[model samples]
Target: MSWGTLRNSGQERELFKRRSFVAIIAIILLTGVLVGRFYYLQIIEHETYATISDRNRLQVQPVPPTRGLIHDRNGVLLAENRPVFSLTVIPEQVSDMDALIEEIRGIVQVRPEDVESFQRRLGERRRPFEPVPLRYHLSESEMARLAVNRHSLPGVETEARLVRYYPYGRLTAHVLGYVGRINEQDASRIDQVAYAGTHYIGKTGLERVYEEELHGEVGYQNVETNARGRVMRVLEREDPTPGRDLTLSLDIRLQQVAHEALGDRRGAIVAINPETGGLLAQVSTPGFDTNKFVTGIDHENYSELRDSLDKPLFNRATRGQYPPGSTIKPMMALAGLASDTVTQSDVVHDPGYYKLPNSSQVFRNWKRGGHGDTTLYDAIVLSSDTYFYKMAYEMGGAEMADYLEHFGFGSVTSLDVSDERAGILPGPQWKRRVHGEPWYPGDSVNMGIGQGYFLSTPMQLAATTSVIANRGARRPPRHLRYIDGDIPARHLLPDVVRPPVEMGEKSDWEYVINAMEDVVHGSNGTARGISPGLNYRMAGKTGTSQVFSLEGEEYDEDEVAERMRDHALFVAFAPADDPEIVVSVLVENGGSGSATAAPVARQVMDAWINGFPEVLTNQAIPGAMENNGPSGRDPQ
Candidate 1:
């Protein structure tokens, strides 16, 4: 058996050799595949792999440029930028958000609202690893505490950034407006790349109107970062372009004077330089401190401002709509002459009240016994309600509306003024569209005296008066005198120019002007008491707008609530023959135009003509005729 086994050894060896060769071939194929894979990754795809590695270590960041400065015509700073400290956080770097927030409370006075706001921003889509603002306006003590606790807090950071500041406080709040922190809504509207590091945006007024010029170009930096995602160094950078400065036409001195003249009363005043259409002063009383709005106004303070009874937040100059009252009489007189509805010498017999041909409603005159026989000039000086009532009936609503539209009424006066309301100038079509009713002759009578459906803003009134001062020339009100920068000439906006209102006879303009002049200077003028110590001659009109209908009852000022009393209004242009300024004043619930509003206008005009010396001197001494008994409260 052993000998037989020895003969089969050669056959077994052959089989073993074949099996070993097959195993060697299989191993060679596997090694070749491994070598090919290494070559492809290291050589062919080197650039792609290297880019991925570099991205993890480097980041591109945006830098916001400095915001523009705002100044008045006198070079007085109205708005500026001040550096402030803020606390910020990066959510991804935080291990436990709630725990981190609780820890932050110990170092600083971190409010629940702050944490809530931070959480809200974290949920919004933003650049990855960008720091979110937690709290602004950090005090020195808070900064110290943060610095000491920095090592323990992973994501917390303290940054110094420039924030918007209003120097005039409540004086220019309505005109200059204010800036506020950018929110999700702002983020959606703005260019994300341009606004990457920017936090503030203009909220209203001139700030909003010229936002594009105020917000500068963004800069970028390629930065190397560490494993923790902190910036190690800036590898490359592109500098940002600064925003252009703006010099507004507002005269701060006049603005302050007008504001002080209004005092505690809720009122508005708009003064325009007749020669240039520049708004010298725009004042809305009971204005709030604009500084609080810039760095996130506290919720309690904001709520107080939002719900105040006096409405300090309201921009009365551009938004308040009130019946023009007798302030529109001069314009109405011009409209009469222009449309051939009435002649300068036309006479109307007034017996205290006027009635439409078929209507039972009787519109009463301010005088119980009216000016017996009144001409156009007599009607204006005495503010005869019956005379204008008949004239309004003659001209009709359509004619009156068309004439007034050319005077910048029923529309916004300035494109630069934000949130301006177009006042209502009622006509037949307007009545049908708004009230779903036909225009009545009674409506015409009421509107003729600037009541019922007629409403006008202070800005519109000032613009209209400018046309009268210029003898038919019209220039829309403007805030920007000029923009200072390297802007292309073609890109600049054209100056606002409007077509002049044509009168039937050139002599008609002088006739109306002379009548307005008599309103303040005539012996029997309603505002005659305010004319004694005039350094200049001025033409003016005074008006009273009723808050509620008397319904045939005599208006008793003492019986009415202060808020429900009549509104006093006055419009005037100084140096009547060669006017330089046009002013419109409105006093809400101020009772009589002569007693409350006219004196204020006189003071403002005196300030503009004679400078700040006159303002102080006039305030020290009362007008000689302060005893004149409420003669300027015209019938509405």
Candidate 2:
């Protein structure tokens, strides 16, 4: 230590000075580089970073308008909106979406679909703080549980919004239809931008047909969101346009009466106002509660409705295809008169069966011993198979079909409902196209009896009956009575117009109508049983369409399985001369039109005509249809 201190004192002083100078220079250069980098970041890229920051707070959202209300003619709400709560989540507020959803599941019922839908929406969202729906239609109890746990969850909120509600759910299901969640098929067909805020779309019936009017224009707004992704305020908004209110021609009371009249049977009843061409009631039973469809029907409940033998999902009033049976005879008789194939005075011998010129095959009548030698009036009143068979053979299928088309057969009517069936009105051309066979004389004979290839829906039958009620004048079988408030909704279809059935003889309208009246009023008429208690004149036809051919065997009602039995049908109009209402009834597998179907029609008709008995007290009317037994009898 003593040697080192004496030898290196000067050398050490110079070396230390040199090292200190080098260190000071190095420190100065490093500080200059740091200052330059800081200036570049803080000043040059300031606006770019500011835009990115703002994007995380601001979002554009759709402002959905209120859905339109639907009402019957009497202002009874058929479809209306009611407040419902849905659980929504702000994505930015939750540290982890999955963890929060899992936590919320413990508080309220969280379906797997809700989670799946939320995940999909989260990825699609452009804004950082917008709320996404997690669960829809929260029950009161579920809402209470979620409220109790609100303190634990930061981003979850219960949002109140109006949802579609059907008060008379099962009563109006078929005609009014119901709204449902938008699905893939719906998304493909609808305008995506317009539907951005909406979840439901019309699925069937008038709701589908008038979708554009019912789904109003979509509006937009810019929103400011907080760091938690909660909407702090709406920055700017364009007002949303609400859908137009629609008014229907349906009478709620008549709808209830007809629905009750069907009563556990698999059937349909369609009633129309002949003067206004508006549907009073359209019923298909057994009906399901329409409210179930508004949000989303569970798979199990939908399965029960779809697989049920009763087929409540099937809109039988407009979609059921059956042999028109004797229900079509009035139209046929009019066709024969116009074509001169048969006349009112013409007579035919009914020996219980009809046979073609050289054919051994026999077409048996519903009556084993038919009315021997019947006129056109008696033919319709007694429902003679031989009389119509003779007329069909002479007029031929093509000519008969041409006339029937004028009465709205071989096509769907203008019922303002979607998916209505246009029942088959077959002829030689149709048979050749469909079955690859030419028409036969037997085919014409079957057609005469409203069987074979001939088919008609209850909707079509109601319109046809109304044509007779109007004395050959025509009108659409429509349900919409008004749009908004006073707009008329009839006399035209999308691309079709039904012309009046002009007769070669003007008096022929009365001629066929008289025969129809005899069916209900005549002593030996097929539907005479309903005549006794009638306060006002009624014209009706009873029909029994064979589900399977008799093939020369006598029909034993007791021997047949209930479903294998014939379809009982009836078509009627009340206060015959000044006709107001036209009703068509079809009882699937019901035994006799007179017994099973006519009574149902009578109850429906009486509901309209004999409504407010206190005011109609001067007029003696049967207070209830129970006064009349299941009435009418026919086939052949």
Candidate 3:
């Protein structure tokens, strides 16, 4: 610059102009690039950025559907729904689940079981932002306290929802069962998407059997939530469909009478419609409140019930298996007639006991001096053990099994409920399979009296009696009568196609029924005590099953404990000409069927006939029931 700076102002001006032009061109290029970038970002990618921003404040919430309702045949609501407040929280919004739960515990009452149940659900597989219930069945004060501190607690919500309720909890506990909250084990068994917002599912009885119809479809809603995950408002909503309601064949009046009949006794009663096979009444005494199971039952109450000696949770009608005792006498009579093992003219002179072909063991009768020269009709009327003992042995185990199978023994009847025990029907094969022993002649002799390994449930007895009333036609016992929209196929199926009991002579049905009629109508019948007020003809059989062995000694009720005594049982059907209702009763540790179970059955049948006059013109007979049975139980 020093060499060329000798008086060159004109050249220096030209250089300055060139430098300014270069700087202006560079500025223009930089401005073009900045504009292009702004256009791409604001116009081309507009929807993408907007969606990303909305994701912070928008959410899709699940709407759980309402559960179904259950009703008796008379339209009496058995199971329903009640509105309640529950506290729920989203783990994604919650910074610390444990800390938030602790804060909730401080604000309101939080039971240890609730916390424990919540923890179990938290570990289950779940989607993001899905609210988990912290506490259910919250009180008004608890909800108010939670609301006061809700602002500080993000991701927490107080939701109002409907929960299951049972109107007659104790009366229908075993029949309808209950629902409980979804837990980890339940989550594993269910479809998470289908049960998104639903927290309850059926656990037992008809509830479990009809779960698909009882739980409806879930819906969804697009909602705008705040920074704390509190829902501001719903933008788009889809309504959830409610579950289908159920109408059962059970009669509430009959159920009440049966329950009352079993008052304070740990027993069961099952009544059936002989024509339609509808379960008119199913009662199990010492029942617990089913509502307690709807929500989480407290640990203390649950433990108390679980440890109780009476087994209130047990369904005696469907599950309690006891020997049929003399209740099977009429059925055995039918078997004898059908198998040609014995004829109506055949007679056996009983000397109070019978001995097997070569065995020395003497099987005695209930009467020390048995009915002399007993015919088939007299055997059923007098409940002569010696005659049945001879018949059972002659019929043989194979023939017995085949005939009894047609009567719904050795298998679960087509009852809709899932929990049912297939009462034991013992034979040579069954004995070998279960006891690892061969069937003996003594076994057959004992079975003649409905003892020794021949076990049956009160439900089975009721169904079998229905078969008898139908005169060899079989109708499988069922509970469902109607549904909200479409009824299940099982309700009116299978039974219709099943073949009627093929008999040597169908008129024998009338013959056996008449013999049973004399048991209640004849002067010297075993159940004549309940026959005084019979407006219409009735047929019945009385039975007593030994709880323990007597070892050839006389049974003294005074020496036996109440629980260790014999179980009294009865099977009967009204209007022997055209039976409408068939009832089977079991009295735990009751002294005699004639004294205990017969009276109970009379009350139930009277209630059915008197309550529904259209069914029959029946009036309640004053002093129709009597307890003047002998001091000794029906040891037969």
Candidate 2 lDDT over 98-146, as tens digits, reads 7888899888888886677677767662334456778888999999999
Worst lDDT run of 10 residues, candidate 2, spans 627-636
Candidates in order have lDDT scores of: 0.85, 0.83, 0.83
Superior candidate under lDDT, 1 versus 2: 1
Summarize candidate 1's per-residue lDDT along 45-76 as a digit string, tens digits: 98998899899998888889889988766556
- How displaced is residue 491 in candidate 2, in Å? 11
Candidate 3, lDDT over the whole model: 0.83
**Per-model RMSD to reference:** 6.9, 5.9, 6.6
lDDT tens digits, residue span 522-543, model 3: 9988889988877778899999
Root-mean-square deviation of Cα positions for candidate 1 versus the true structure, in angstroms: 6.9
Top-lDDT candidate index: 1
